[model samples]
Structure formats: structure tokens, C-alpha cells
Target: MPHPSCARRWAMPKKAKQADLKKLAICVGLGAAIWAIPAPAGVGLPAWRLLGIFLGTIAGIITQPLPLGAVAMMGLGAAQLTGILTFQAAFSAFANEIPWLIAIAFWLSGGFIRSGLGARIAYSIVSVFGKTTLGLTYSLTLAEALLAPAIPSVAARAGGLFLPLAKALCLACGSDPANGTEGKMGSYLMMTCFLSTTISSAMFITAMAANPLAVNLAAETLGYTISWGTWALSALAPGLVCLLLTPALMYVLYPPQVKDTPDAPAKAKEELKRLGPMSRDEKITAFALGLTVCLWIGGQSLGINAVAAALAGLSILLVTNVVTWEQCLSDNQAWDTLTWFAALIAMAAYLNKYGFISWFSDKVVGMVGGLGLSWQAAFGVVTALYFYSHYFFASGAAHIGAMYTAFVSVSIACGTPGIVAALALGQLSNVMGCLTTYGIGSAPPYYGTGYVPQAKWYQFGFIFSVIYLVVWVGVGSAWWKVLGLY
Candidate 1:
């Protein structure tokens, strides 16, 4: 007989396959249900058919019936096979600059981890402000904000850098979930770190994997161009307010039992000492990141495309041997993001091109118009509905794919400014990830630490969701008005 462990491993795949098939059936059922409906007047048959395939693709993304890339590939193949899109059109997004920008940025982000610059920065912050529990949390928040632009994946930053550091800080303070002492400091630290990641993700277009997707969708759906600088500048004020307030709010609401953490700064100092001086690779990575950020900020004025800047930075890293070609190939997340992102962009672009989005937008506008509210009031209602709808979504990318365009359309149709609608919806797309533990890529690992209970997690998630909405809408809107975005 085969070893029991080997037998169990083999059985796991079969069970997973069964579960995947069930989810696949649900996705297919949803597509078929929509596909069977008659195409609306003024919407072509092909556009209607593509909507079904797109919705099914989004379903597959949310339900994870297969790897995201595989599901997207299948969706593209379906679109082509059904004659909704030609072979050339189905694969066209692979050539688009947005997908390549994100993928190249991902590779560039790897330098932070490989060179240990990310950890060094985190440690240096902790060494300064870690004497108090609240201070430690702020240090982590600051570190995260600093790293956000360079690190595209919130999960990688939170899980790989902050989570480990938070756990270490917990142990140093005599707090551990394993010992029923998490409430002392671990719970507060974990919750703050997790919540702050969402804010940092919103602060930059390159901060999260799905952010560029929002940028692409906004441009394609609304004809509102959002450059890297524009996104960063618009978010600067509101994002900073949220970041500064998150630690204090959590401190007040979920106060740590151990307020004075004298050991933390010392621990951080020891960590810094062990890390020693910055290596040559770290210096090179920092220079490359600095050059890239400067370019991203002013490259447009200088006639340098954002994608070109990213490619240039990546090229510098490659030439210096900071990260190898083999390492780039081995980065499954980067490649997978490129694949699904390209597919979704193609589908969404065609949805606009084929006029399905416009038809759907008309229906939504008619419904909202019947309420007879001012456009501001109408936008508020739509924004709230859109923000809270994340309860039904597990992936930000899936949520963006399914709802972002339609909501932006309705907002603009109701007389909301096009840039205002696109940017508001774009920022909320990242902030809304706070609603559930599975809401985004970064939530699970922090929650899985067993520091915060499920009930409290949801409770805090809801509370922060409201807080985020208020800050983004009130403060963000005022700032945008001053900048003449409207």
C-alpha cells in the first residue's frame, strides 16, 4: 500500500478538483442564464454574448474555479469560439501598455525583498518610534506607506514584512495568541497593520496589483485619463489623513494592554544591527526606485511614458544583476497578473467598444433618475451602494471587472464630473477591501494569526469602512475641488 501521507496528498487534489468543478458549474450556469436572455434593443447580439462571457469570467475570478490566469484564458477562448471576438481581438490586450507596466513593476518590486531594503526600512522606523505600542503601530504604518509605491502586492508587503515583524513585536511584549495573550498587544498591532495596508494601497496606483486595472477601466469606460502623478497627487491628502488617523483610532477603540513597550525599540535596534549597513544591492535598489518615482511623477511633462520609466528602472535592476532573468521568470504572481489582467482589459475594452456598457449605463441612469435627486445626492447613494457591495466580492479585481464601469457610467450620466466619478470609485475599490477577511489579497494572513476574533474583525471592518468613506468623500472631494479635477 502507498504511504498514508502520500495517499492523503493524492486525495486532496481530487477533492479540490471536485470543488473546482462545482464552482465551474455555477459560473457556467450564471453565464447561460444571462446568455439566454434576448439582447436589449440597440445592443448587438455579439455584445450581449460577450457580456455573458465577461460576467462568467468575473465569476470564475471570484469563485476561484481555477487559477485566475487559467480562468481568464478560458474566458478569452470562449469569447473567440462564440464569435463575439476574433482571435486577434481576444489576444490584443497582451500588447497593451497597462498590463506590461504592472508586470514590469512587479519585477521591479522584487528588488526590495531580494536586497532586504524593505526590512531595513521597517526596522529603522521601529527603532525610532517603537517605545510605545501606538508609536510602534505608527512606525509600521509609516514604513508601509514608504514601501507601498515600490511594492505592488499588499499581501507581499504585509505578509512578508509586516506580519513577521508584528508577530516578533508581540513576542517581545509578552503577547501571543498561542498563550491567550494576544489582546495585550498582538491584536491591536495586527489589526492596525492590516487596516493600514488598505490605505497605503489606495495612496498609489502602483501600490496594489488591481490598482492599474482600475486606472485602465476608468480611461476605457469614461475617457478620463488618470496618470501616475494624478492618482498620487489626488490621493495624497486623503490618504495621509487616513494613515495618520488609523493608528490613533485603533488605539482608542482597541487599546493595547501593554502601553509602554520599552523592549520594542531595543528589539528593533538589535534587528537593525544584525542587518548591518545597507549592502551594494540595497543601495542600487534604492537608487533605481528613486529614479523610477521621479520619472513617474514628472515623466509625462518630459515626454517619457510611464511604462517606459518602469521599463527603464527594471532594466537598470536587470543590468546590475540586482534581480536575474531567472528570478523574473520564477515570479509567478507577476506573470499571472499579466495574463488575467490582459484578458480582463481586452474583455472590458470591447464591452465599451461594442456599446454594451452604454446600454447598461442607460438602464442604471433611468433607475437613478427616477428618484429625482440632485447628481450629488445620486452619486452619494450610488457610491455607498458600490462601496458596501464588496460584501459579495472576494477579489478586488473581480469587483472592478464586474461593477466599476457601470457605476462610473451612472455617476457621470447623473451629472457627476467624469474625473470625480472615476477617481472616487477607483479609490474606494482599494479601501473597500477592508470589509471582509477574504476581501483582498492582504486580509487573510493577518486574520489567520488568530489575534483578532472573527466577530471583532467584521465589526472593525464595518466601522473602518464607514470611516474610510467619510474621509475620502468629505476630505478627498474638497481636495479634488481645489485641484480643479471636477
Candidate 2:
């Protein structure tokens, strides 16, 4: 080790400069200072500080200067307490549909995971395509993608299924969990699986409970007609493509390469052998899920809505003992996540109700209208609106609840196509996940697991956000136009 002075002179910029520590500290310090204020008014230095905090946060999120979730919650609490927003308004986020959907679905997914049912399902997927690493990765992704459009819970698919199986595979491959490639792979794959599931959750109406409301609002407010299959079809390309690439991307992101081990230990082999068959719970859960899909699609085609379809499946499960109320209630992360989601949705809706969003949006639109670049000006509004969304919402549904109608209505007034707006809004729901780890539509269970460090998670978020923004604005624009959505 070098002397303190010499080290200070030579050490940091190369190896120690991995993160913008000073910036993070400044933001955190200032954010905490604002948080300490009794009144969060936007009028004086406090107001200016609050504004700086807000702009700084957005800038940081765009630049990934820190953790998004921590920052979001801090902002939430501060804005409310400081009088910038009402407590009722701040707390109102808990009542939102998106949060409710996200939280409740986790319980639904948890029951499946806790009951050993999720494993049997994974084993089946692996049985079909677990020979090669790529095959296994794709197989897991396919299971997620296929179910993503219908299942409200992603944790069950990622944490419950993928993580466990990946771990088992690592163990089987002689990879030590104590440290190194195996552990990294497990962590990385788990993150990938979680992120993919969150993004994919935007693919269908039933994929998340908030979706129906989003669709309904768009329909009611903007006369947009978003059929279930049509919505899925619109999102499947981008969402699925993302899911397919995620495993490989994460593999690189984490960079873990350990070959499979020879075989299982004799004792472990015996245990595996004795693991003889899928548990009864597994059998029923699998059957129930399959039936749920059929009924969900067929029932909806028969004119049933996603909620009705979900309730129908849920009811049937409760009646059949597939998932009991006790089990559902016991799954803390599941329901908590949903409640959190609901709060977000409610808050967004409340913002609109209070004229907060409309006032802000009107001013923004007014400012852009003067530029006179018509389409480009319009794009600026869309992009700004999308960025603002993460500040308030934690998921796609929440974003939809907050701004779907407002954005669409304003777009139409500006001569943007309704179809274009719908697709843009839908895709924005998935894309926002990149802004922050917590901003992920389906992230609670993943985040709650304590694997992805809050800061690194935010880092991943910003990087992914750039990818999403470019993809949607640059590539998606042309695709939507060519597809006649414009």
C-alpha cells in the first residue's frame, strides 16, 4: 500500500472511480436536508431545494447517480410532508389499482412457489430443454414469456421458479455457492429473470391487473379500442424480444462461466431419486394454471373481462383448494407489493383529480406548442411525460393510472394518432423499468429479495433506460408508423 498522500494522488481515478461517490453523497445529503424540513413548500429556499432535489433526482435517475427506489420514497415522503402535496394525496397512492394488482398477484404467485408447485413446473420446462445453458435459459424465459401475458405475479416465475432452479443447477454443476461463478450466475440470472418478468408483464391485460384499467381508461377517455389479443400482439414483439435477450445479457453483465459438474452426490442422487414424483400440490397447481389460461382466453373471447377472468380462476382455485385464502394472505411480499402498486396508481389518479398533472401538463404543452416543430415538439412532450412518470409511479399500471388518459387526450388535441398514442403508452409502461430498479412494474418481490444491491440496481436501471428510450423513440416510432398504428 502506498502512503496516504501518495495513494490519494495516484489511487482513485482508475480503480476507485467506479462510481460517482461525490455526486451520490451530495444528492443524498441535499435530499436528506430537504427531507428534514417540516414544510415541503416550493416557494423559498426550501422550495428551491425541493426543486433542486426533484430535478437532481430526475437527472440522477437519467444518469443513474443513485438508487431509484430509495430516492422515490424519499421524494414521496418529502413532497407530501413539505406541503408541496397533501398527505391524503401522498398516501392516496396506496389505493391505486396497479399497486393492488401487483401486490395481490404476488400472493397468488407465492402460494404456487411455497406449495412446491412452481418447482414441478420448472422441472417440466427443464425436462424439455435443460441440456445446454442456452437451452435452459431460453426455456426459462419461454415459460415466463408464455405466462407473462396472463399471470399477474412475476416473483413466482422468477424468484420462486427460476432462481431456485438456477441454484440447483449451479449446485449440480459443482459450482460453489460460497463464492464465484455459480453464485454470480444465480444472482445474475435471478436479476435477469426478475427484470424480464417485469417487462413482460406489460404484454397482456391479464399479465397485470392494472392493465385492464389502463386499457379501459384509454378506451373511455380517448376512444382507443385495445382488445386483449391486440394489446398482447402489439407488445409481444418488444417485450418478448427483451425477455429473450435478457438471459444472455445478464450472463454477460454478471459474467459467470462454470461447466456442469459430473453428477449429483450419491446421497443427493438418492434424494433426487426419492423425490420420485411431483407433489400433489404441484400436480393440481399445474393443472389449475393450464385451465386458468384456457378459461382466461376462451372466457374473455366469450366477452369476459380480465378481472372477471382472474376472479373466475381465483374463485375456482379457492373452491378446489388449489390456493386457499390463508395462503394468499400469508404471502406478505405478494400482497404488500400489490398494495404498494395500488397506492401508486391512486396517487397518480389523485394527481390528475387535483389538477396537479393537468396543470403541469398544460403548461408543458403550452411551452412546446410555441416551438412549432409539430411532430418533434410533440415527441418532446411524450418523452418528458415518460420521464416524469417514474417520479410518481413504480409500475406500468401506475403510470397508466396517472397519465394514460391525460397523455392520450393531449396527444389527440395535438394531432397525434390515437393508435400511436396507445402503443406509445403501452410500450412506455414497459420501458419505464429502466429508469430505476424499483420503477419496474413487477419488481417488488425481486427487490424485496435483497439480492440486487439498491445502488447497483439503479445503475442497471439507468443503462437499461437508455436502451429502452432509444429503442422506443428511435426504432419503435418507425415500427408503429409502418404498422399503421400511426
Candidate 3:
């Protein structure tokens, strides 16, 4: 009481400790609650499986090891146990061409990373652009855009390469990678880097693993073939424009922090220099990745299969001693992702086989009709379904399985552009999944990062979701209409 300053100082540490404890308590409580749920959708698709998703998501948000892939497996097991899904129906994601493609893509990406080619490319970009935060913005966005068309794994695209280097750049720019990023220019930088991967990847047919699946779902289910090249050019134009402008957006979204170091950018450059010359692994990675791109563009006209192209590249990597099978096996995300996608895809096929998704959509259409909305209202309802309907899926491929048929039927009823509607729905699967980091697409790696706080990361995600829903949709609608995709 006699020393006012001492008392004020003394109270701060206790408050800080209490806040940390509170956060821990909240994470634990959420995990427990999710872990304890009853079965969902039925006994096999138990409530606990859904809860496992919740728990896994929570674990990602908190950087905990809650076993997300396990959660997905449990979901499949529930489907089997409860007879909601047959073994073939539940396990087919593993066998599908699409899931295999994604798995293969991850393996290739892993080889590149382990080969040190990824870091070499990253370092090359940084050497050219790491001098300032603004410079870094361009480099980060550009690198991702360039890579988007080739590598389908957004996790590998963003988390493996994008996040690490981007964080290092920010750290070098004197921006703290800690809790204070929100109010600083660094926050905007981080946000933009994260979302840009999603945006740019939206452009190419193979920009994302989901894109091919989405495109195929439309062709097979709706009888239209929107070729790989079309999406690449159409979506890419706007995507590049959006990416180029992200630096400016970040500048406006969060002004430079007063306390941030001015010499941060230079520091990062120096650290990069210390890495010295590129190693053999790095050299192989670059040549292989570059060759992969060349093959992708060239193979399209040469009648080469995309999967075959990937296999060939992977073969080269293994043959050249650029990568080992152990590296491939140790790639937890790659393996786990294949399994995860396979399970969800299997579940999706199951729903289609069982008439569950179509049945549910019929109910929705009937209920939506009862609201007495105008054609525009119907449009909005259908559109909302296109975006928000990802709730029932554990992967983007799964979403298509569950809703592609209904989406096509709705378009037919509304006299909308069938191909456009299909593409829109497919795009929405990605966009909606972006809403929550734990959504079907990017949930795994996102949840596994222990550095960022869950609330904060989610805060970024919510903002990001709104941007995609509002800005991207608005822009994409116009773009699709222009291309007659709408």
C-alpha cells in the first residue's frame, strides 16, 4: 500500500500467468468435450467422430497433438461399425485416382523439400526480395502463385515453404513472430501469405489437389468438361491481380508497428547469406521441380497423363538419389493427408451410393421453397449452399461426393449455367473450407502449428473467410460470368 509502483509491477506477472492458465484450461476443456461425444449421424458415424474432428481442430489451433488423421479414421470406422457406409464406400478414397494424385503430389513435394531445392528457391527469392517487408510481400505472393499450378498440396505450398520463410523474413524485418503480430504490418503480411496460397491455387486445374477432383466431379456428374487450362487462365488472371495487391492491402490493414525494428529485413538477408552455397540436394530439387513444371505444360499436348507425369518425376527423384523412401515415409502430412482424403472421399461416395446427400439436398430444396423467396432468393439460397455446405465434408473431394449431384440438379431447376454452377460449387468447397482452419482442406497442418494461439489464428481465419466469401465471390462471379462459366 505504501509503494504504489511496486504493487502495480507485482500484479502484472500474476495476471499474465492467470491468462496463460485460462487459455490452457479452455483448450483442455474443449478437447475433452470433443473426445467425450456420442456417435454422430448414426452409431458408426458416431458423435465422437465429429467430436474427434472438433478435438483435432482444437489441437491444431492450440498446436496440440490430438491425432487428426486418427480422428478421420475413427469416423470411417464408425461408418463401418454402424453400417452407414460399406467398407468399399468408406475406404475408396485411398483407391481413387484423385486421392492418389494428391498423395503423389505430396511425395514429390517432400522430395523437393528434403532435397533442399525448396529452401534454395526460397533463399533465391529472399536474396532478391528480403530487403524490406514490402519487398518480401511481393516475393512471398509471387513464389506461391508460381508454385500454385504445379503443387496441389496447399499445406505443402503454404506451411512447408510459405510460412517458414515468410516468418523468417518478417523476423528479419524486425517484426516479432510472437503475439504482437496482430497490430503490426507483419500480421497483414502473414495473413496475406496464408490466403494467397488459397487464391493462386484456385487458378490452375492442378493448382490444388481438390481442383482436379472438383473439375472431374462436374464433368462426370453434370456432363461438361471444363478443361484444366481454362481454369488456369481464367482463375489465374484475377488471382495474380489479387496477389500482387496483397502487399498494399496489408499496409492498409495494419500500419507498421511503432516498436518494430527498422533493420529487420537486412538481418534476414544476413542470416540467409550464412546458409552459404546451395548443396547437392538443393541442386537436384531445383532441376527436378523445374523439370516438373516443364513437363506439366508440355505434357498436356503430348498426351502424357498428369499422374504419369508425377510418377515419372518421382522416379527421377528416387533414381537420382535426390530423395529416399524413408523421407517419403517420414512425411507425416503426406501419408496422413492421403489417408484423410481417402477416408472422406470414401465417405462421400458412400453418401452418394446411399442417396443420403441427394436425399438431404431434396429436403433442403423443399425447405428453401417454403420460405417463399424470389428467384434471386433461390439464387442466394443455392449460392449459400454452394459455399457453406462444406460442413458435412471432411475433405473437399468428400463435399463434391455429397453435394455435386444436388448442386447440378438445383442448377437444372434454376436454369443456371450447369458448368458454371458446378465450378462455383467446387470453388465454394475450397472457400468454405478456408473459413475454419480445421475445415476439410487445410485443417491438418494448420492445426499442428504450435507457435500461434488458436484464438488468434482463428481470428485470422474468420477474417480470411469473410474476404473469400465477399470479395472473391463478388470478383469470381463477374469473372465466371465473363468466361461463361456462370
Q: What is the TM-score of each candidate against the true structure?
A: 0.65, 0.66, 0.67
* lDDT, candidate 3, at 156: 44
- Which residue pairs in candidate 1 have backbone atoms (N, alpha carbon, C) closer than 3 angstroms, thus clashing? none
In terms of TM-score, the best-performing candidate is: 3
Tell me which of candidates 2 and 3 scores higher on TM-score.
3
Kindly provide the TM-score of model 3 when superposed on the true structure, using C-alpha atoms.
Answer: 0.67
Best by lDDT: 1
Cα error, candidate 2, residue 30 (Å): 4.2
Q: After superposition on all CA atoms, how large is the RMSD of candidate 3?
A: 9.3
Per-residue lDDT of candidate 3, residues 1-486 (tens digit) = 011121111122211212244544555566456556654343344334434433433343334333345546755665566554567766776766554555566666555545544444445555666555576677768877787766665654555445545544443343443334434445656666666666776667676667777777778767777887776655654565566655666566544553334454464456556656777666776666556556655676787655666667777788887766766666565566666656655654555555555556777766765666664456567877766656445566666656766766666566666766666566556656655444544444433322334565566656666666665556776887787674
Please give, for residues 243-312, the per-residue lDDT of candidate 1 as tens digits.
9999999999999998886777788778778878788888998888778767765675788766777777
Task: Give the least accurate 10-residue stretch of model 2, judged by summed lDDT.
Answer: 1-10
Could you tell me which 10 consecutive residues in candidate 1 have the lowest summed lDDT? 1-10
lDDT for each candidate structure: 0.77, 0.55, 0.57
Of 1 and 2, the candidate ahead on TM-score is 2
Candidates sorted by TM-score, best first = 3, 2, 1
After superposition, which runs of candidate 1 have C-alpha atoms over 4 Å from their true positions? 1-19, 131-241, 244-262, 374-377, 382-467, 470-486
Least well predicted 10-residue stretch by lDDT in candidate 3: 1-10
